[model samples]
Target: MATEREIFSNSGPLDLTAVDWTNSQHRRTVAASLVQGTYSMEHDRQQKLQGHLALGPPWWEFFNFQPVQVLVDEHDLSIFGAIFKFKFPPSYGNYLPQNPPQYVVAFRGTITKTDTKKQDLKLDFQFIRNRLHQSTRVHLAMQAVQNMVSIAGAANIWLAGHSLGSAIALVAGKNMVKMGCFIETYLFNPPFTSVPIERVKNEKLKHGIRFTTSVIKAGVAIALNSQHQRSQKDHSFNILSGWIPYLFVNPSDPICSEYIGYFEHREKMMEVGIGNIARLATQNSLGNLILGATGKDSEPPHLIPSAYLTINVSPTQDLKQAHGIQQWWKQNINCQFKLHQYR
Candidate 1:
């Protein structure tokens, strides 16, 4: 964790003109287009874009990947380039029952590409820190929220994203709640490469905000350790747990059980519930055998029943084929053990 003073002193002024903004824009355009095209193909639909790039049909359709439409039309006031909103259907079963239709919005304008040439010249530290970029993303998200509220009416909102998007979502959600809006956020695999880990630690000390974030343990060890620093702080905005729930469904490796146990120890530090889906897999493979909790003190307090109405696919069965532990939980764990699979 770098101090604000250290970041400012060590990171010198940036020469924006020295870096080819035009080339950067071209690279960004290409990247964004590829993402848009890939998603459009998966959805089996085309969205009109103000840009000139035209994408082909879904390439991953054979993989059974569902296309989620995240509006990216810069020409429309209803949508914008910086903000992307995608609605996941109830059929997805990730949402809680009785909750309003949930939408996840990604604030995408915060990433700043460094001027490598200036670094070679020893003159790349005067302009702005990467956190400033995150701050800009926060501003853009606030504007988007104001616009969304006008058109969509009041609804439950969830924030999610990877990398820079994840960091922006965390900061934006915090600001949104300060404005009296109820927002819950989920961060997926954010890295601590650019921002100072200590700033994130300090921000989590604020009160009166409701934000829940999940990060892959391996993906954010440094950030996780920073969050752990303020574990005992009694603030509404602070992260209740040092580490979020650990998903343990990697059957290929023999030491996976040990890894799960390691994360479970950290989870216990925060007093958050530990979701054990491992036993459920065994029960599903063994012909409807009821697996009881290993002990009376188990967090969930019961074995995940085989008769649990899993949406369309067996949640436990899906875990067996999961490539990563995170995917297993996202696909198998419903709001409260109710598994729903997309068709």
Candidate 2:
């Protein structure tokens, strides 16, 4: 109650351009727990963000971000995302961090197949870009990013996503960098593309990908999501230097199961649970969907041969182990190994 009252007394909800979750050590610790595929701890972290917690590993004094504004549609909560700004806590300048933190934009992924409109939007984002956000609350978040650049001169930014969100991050990264901002994007289990990876590089963006441990195990065939079965790469596999794409794969993911070695060190080994397992199953269901949801002829463009994976084991158990956000935090980030360096 006190927390709510204090928030109400504030000038406004947290501003998106000022708070940086990336700089919070405590936040990173909680994210690491999620990477280990623990959703309970992740929920606690979310509650902390909501200011419902009385105490935790650290106080708000060291907090790196605030609620700011979450972009969501009034009618449907599923079709929404959020934008968070970086806030320098007290003593922040005393202990100068290595790099200046930037704003983070997180696009939520699809969890259920019940919402047909939301499902169509994901398809459009993947297959066509006639209109994204479609006057939805995301426009407000995009406007905030514009203010961060044109108004605040904060050029550094980080883009992140999961499942369908990863696909969205790619587009956002492309647009932001073209705006002349240095953008670093992290994609957790982005869908595969038979279209030469080089083709996307022509668009000029540096990004990273993460997957499950089972996907990396021997004998699992890999495949990308296919929105339009007709869409394919005009050229063969041609590696390009301009776009640096790092892939992180763990165990048992239906979408990103195996790494065919796009590049050395591009793929990293990682380590997940029921909430996570449930999510993995949900992601698997994506395969049979989109086609039905959007009334398209085919499922979202899954690459030939893959985005294809040869699953020898029970899909439930296999998909249970997913390469989503949690493993990315545990292995690629907040880990003693610091495997990201290799990428």
lDDT of 2 by residue, 202-270 (tens): 322312222332232111111333433212221111111122333333325535433332221132231
**lDDT value, candidate 2, whole model:** 0.37
Error of 2 at 194 (Å): 5.2
Once fitted onto the true fold, the runs of candidate 1 whose alpha carbons sit more than 4 angstroms away are 1-53, 56-104, 107-134, 150-154, 192-233, 236-266, 270-343
TM-score of 2: 0.47
lDDT of each prediction vs. the true structure? Answer: 0.29, 0.37
Over 1-343, each residue of candidate 1 has an lDDT whose tens digit, in order, gives 2222112123211111122213422222222222233333212322343222223222111111232444332222222123333333455477433442234354322212231122211211211222322233346656665666566543544454333344455455545554656454433332222112222224444111111112232223222224442232213223322212111223222212222222322333235432222211211111111111122111110111111121112233432232221232222233222221111
TM-score to true structure, per model? 0.33, 0.47
